[model samples]
Target: MSSGSNSARRVASLLRPSIIDSGVCRSCQETIGRRSYATATPAATESTTTPPVVTPAYTINAGVVLSRPPQITRELEPFEKAFFFYQKRLNERLALPFTKYFYFKRGTPADEDWKKKIQERRTAARDIGKYNAYDSDAWNDELLLGAEQSEPANQVEALVQDAESTANATSQDTSKKEDIPRPYPRITEADQKNDQKSLNRLLSRTLYLLVQSKEGNWKFPTSPVETGETLRLAAERTLSESAGVNMNTWMVGYHPVGWHKFNAPRAKKGETAKPDASGSKVFFLKSRIMAGQADLSINTQNLKDFKWLAKEELPQYLNTQYYSNIKNMLADR
Candidate 1:
């Protein structure tokens, strides 16, 4: 072929448009629709020096350029694009100072009311503290000032002053008084023997076994009746307070009653054994579990370990030292 003809054919081939149906055209059409049309001229060259056609690295729509080209890199799904627009609008709204201010004080009035109430409460508490004096000198001064203002010559006034002075003196004396120590009861030899017999009888009585946890340890809830409270009440309260278990009904059986005394070497000097005081009372009381009485409050204050065991399993469940009582109780049952 002639050189001019060959050159003409090459230019024509490069200029010819690639065939594109609706689907392929739609992809490019969307980007073209959003951008301003530009006329780009093909450069003329004879030595095959064709300048590269620089297509957009990203898709453009309505003057908006995507960072990553949706058509070429990764096309965004409709939902994804919708989400992007939503996030874009959200960011734009957040940038506005008015929007920020509106949200900042949205519930501020209610919060302010709460803060005001708290301040008022604090003020009242301070006022109460101001009235309650801790210093003895301040209290005495107030009392004396009140007394001095009274008419001393009048008999009624003198009487009132005397009463006030007496009351003040009593108050001061009461504040100075030492805490009274509880005196241990004295047990005579006859009483001790009687108590021993009573204890033996108590031991022979039936007792319901219940385990409770206290201070990370397990302790049997047993007590002798003394002072004001009954044995049953004492046992129940001790169990409840220590192990969180409430004893409802007891199935008392034959239990041994015994009295045992030990001279505690740890007792302080001059601390003689008081007569009429029983060393210990051992008794058995039978009881049953009550529903809804199980303590669910988790506290290590009084107890730590706990379990309920049947009479048959008592030997295996309890330590060896506790077996004798369990065995006797079961035999009695």
Candidate 2:
């Protein structure tokens, strides 16, 4: 024990200068002989806690505007120039400028005077060497400022003669249904705006006279104006529901023009049919179609097929009075 104590004192004395007296503190000196002083480190008695992680540095500047983010989920259907016809005048009337189209049902009054006006216009177009233009591509930008041409006097004799014959027939038989005069001349009318692509992929706006199907159908996509609805809204709803009009297809152009009226048979079922007096009035809204592939899947109306045709091509497909009605409203760009 005496020899071991003497050896420990000698080792402590040797470590005193370097571990305690020269640089190391008093606590290190006390541990020199008891434990190895090879490398200095924090004591084993230290806590088991981990150091906190630092975040990436960022600086917000003063006066930097922080706009609120847009709500993507609440995005609504767009209207007008916001979606189509990027180069149109604001507040300007939207005009597709269709050739006014109409057709008389069988047993309806046929006006020959109206026929003369249409023939005149067709002749005038041919006289001007615009026969090709009559069938060619156009933007329908024609400035038409005059009143519609009046029906000619030539048909007055024919109308009176027909009336006399009808009167004589009625006088002969009071039981005949045709003897009673109708409040309105039964007819059906439609706007015929045609859309098709030219050879160069240019969009064409030719007018067409669509033929009625075998069951007597083919009418414009239209509906009655609901209560508290504006004309524009009603037209929009009608076109959307009846024609599958989508935002990408057409742009609603202007306030509706005056309503077009036509007559029809009563909607009553399983009974003797009556005249639809006060006739059906359809409000027209001119619209520019951006493309042709319209979603024509109307579940409610009977529409079989459609095609776009120029006005010159309509003579073979349309009745004379109906063609006359269209010609009176026709203009050129």
Give TM per candidate: 0.26, 0.32
Task: Report the Cα lDDT for candidate 1.
Answer: 0.38
lDDT tens digits by residue: candidate 1, 1-333 = 799999988785465423353544765656654555346868866687778765432221110000101112223444554454344334543444443224345468765674454344322111111121212322331222223222222323333444454465567566553332333223335345644211121222232333444434232444344467554555454445544543344423323232222222344687874433333334434444433233426423344444443344455555565455345534332
Candidate 2 structure quality by residue, lDDT tens digits, 158-215: 3444455447655857665443343321121222222321111111323432323336
Q: Least lDDT summed over 10 consecutive residues: which range in candidate 2?
A: 59-68
Q: Give stretches of model 2 more than 4 Å off.
A: 1-214, 250-252, 264-278, 315-323
lDDT of each: 0.38, 0.40
Worst 10 residues of 1 by lDDT: 61-70
> Relative to the unseen true structure, what is the C-alpha lDDT of residue 238 in candidate 1, on a scale of 0 to 100?
47
